[model samples]
Target: MSELIGRLIQPRQPAFWFMVVLNALSMVLAWLAQKPELTLTVSLLIAAFALGNAALGAFFAWQLIRRPAK
Candidate 1:
C-alpha cells in the first residue's frame, strides 16, 4: 500500500498535480451525487466544473500517451 502511494506522488510534475486535483474533484462530485436536496444552481455549477475538468484531464492524458516510454 505504501509503495503504491509513494509511486503515485514521486513524479512531482504537472501530471501529478492534475491527478491530485482530479482526485479531490471526484470526491466532491461523489459526495454531491449522494445528496438528494441540492439546488439547481449548485447542481449546474458542479456539472460545469466537471466538464472543465474533463477537458483538462483529456489534454493531460493525451500528453501522457504521447510521451516516449523510458
Candidate 2:
C-alpha cells in the first residue's frame, strides 16, 4: 500500500473545468429525469449522484483557481 501510494502523483493539468461541465450536464439530466413518467426511486438516485459529482467539480474548480499556475 505504501509503495502504491508513493507512486501516485497529482496530474499537472487540473481538469477542473472539464469536471464542472460534466457534472453540470449530469445534474441537468438528473433534473430532466424527474418527469411524471419517470420512476421516483431512479430519479432520486440519479439526482443524488448528480449532486455529488457537482460538489466534487465545484471543489476541484475552486482549488484549481486558487493556485497560481507554475
Q: Which stretches of candidate 2 lie over 4 Å from their true place?
A: 1-12
Kindly report which residue pairs in candidate 1 clash with one another. none
How far off is model 2, as Cα RMSD? Answer: 9.5
In model 1, the Cα lDDT at residue 30 comes to 55
RMSD of each: 5.0, 9.5
| lDDT of each residue in 40-70, candidate 2, tens digit only | 8877877777777777776666665555454
1-70: candidate 1 lDDT, tens digit per residue:
6544454453545776785577578567756755669887887777777766767765655554455433
Computed on alpha carbons, the lDDT of every model, listed in order, comes to 0.63, 0.64
Where's the lowest-lDDT run of ten residues in candidate 2? 2-11
- How far does residue 4 in candidate 1 sit from its true spot (Å)? 20
